[model samples]
Target: MKLAELEVNGVSWSPTKASLPVLHPTTFTVGAGKVLGVVGPNGAGKSTLLRLLYRFQKPQTGYVRVGGQDIWDMPARDAALCIAAVLQEQASAFGLTVREIVRLGRTPHRSHYATSGARDEQVVEHVLGFLNLHPLADRDFGTLSGGERQRVMVARALAQEPQVLVLDEPTNHLDVRHQLEVVSLVQNLGLTIVVSLHDLNLAARVCDDVLILKDGHPQGFGPPQTLLTDSLVSDTFHVDARREQLAPSGASHFSFSLPN
Candidate 1:
């Protein structure tokens, strides 16, 4: 259930000969029950790294491991069982109902042409309840608004019962409240999560660790307070990160100040 000493080395992905690499050589590790925040500019390969780790594409070199075992060496089904991904584009293309789409999360555990048993149903119910999706469970997937659809995707991923949850731009279409709710749910799950986020402040609030990427390479990696500073933000994001302290808890937050 924990990822210890995880590393990705010499990993590159190129679709065409002249096409630039999606992910250049990158290496980093995340511990268990901790959230890793990935931040970068538009083309920093944050999504590419998530794809490589989730086996959407094979790495040209190096490795991805879970618990000291090479992920590629593990059976694909087994890997799917342990790692659940909630990608930005995983919308229901088939017009499936919300509950039905979420139930598909159990596919990795199914045998040949098998149906979901009572346990799978229980998990699906649990996930919907956890995400507060019971009110919308019977809705058609395509009929939901962007934020609603996004929550459905999160529920699906949670229904898989994975130890490691990977989210790529999960808050892309969400409003402020939904964003906080979805992030809170993920944080409370106590799962090893690697979430690629464009909003650096949200990352600081939700994640325990951080990895900064620029042009498909690592710019920095560490705790949020250490990595989310003014200089690094200015360098990687080309903007100043101004700090402010919140009330009561007095937790620090940041704002992006534009260049003159």
Candidate 2:
């Protein structure tokens, strides 16, 4: 993966021609190697927005550009070479092994009727070892626990060797340890990533910049320290959020109370 810039320009989407917009016009930018977190309530179009970024769906009104190229204008295979995404859904383990799942990431790199090559194998092997999935390589993907499965999903995405990775709720369904580990692994990956998160605290720690979405529109966009204020959280999320500094590190920690 290499440094890449991502830009979404006033994008919006609707499920049907006559339906209300699922996402209102919104825009944001991620500089090279920066992590951007998308935070929003359910149906806020977080996933829908990600779909546009990765070329799964095109915005009805605006456009997404990666590395100065419009994603919609790029060929599907070309887009996959630059960007790979992992959504909340996991591949069913039914008959596939972990290694097989990861190896599938090379699909974009393969031409029609082409089989896996030595280079593809090398890439898959390296990603397996990097993510500590080597031990599970031979195991059935379905047998792994929730956290382990998420790691495999991430491994698959990494195997693509993309310049920009988009993940939707990557931390979902994981316990505390795995959640932190996943976030840490993502931060450590020396590439640009756009991820959607439900946990405000985790988003604060992982994101260099945060895009707060409310019913398809941006409520705020900036560094977490500047954007995630008490009033913003209270008004947008309807939670009484308390910000606290923890230990000598002075990192931010937060607690919340429901509105009375």
* Model 2 lDDT tens row, 85-115: 9889875667899999999999999999699
True-vs-predicted CA distance for residue 243, candidate 2, Å:
1.4
| Regions of candidate 2 where Cα sits further than 4 Å from its true position | none
Writing each residue's lDDT as its tens digit, candidate 1 over 30-127 gives: 77778899999999989888988888878876788866777789999988877889898864458788999889988988887899999999999998
Candidate 1 Cα outliers beyond 4 Å, as residue runs? 1-10, 16-20
* Cand. 2 Cα-lDDT: 0.89
Q: Which window of 10 residues has the lowest lDDT sum in candidate 1? A: 1-10
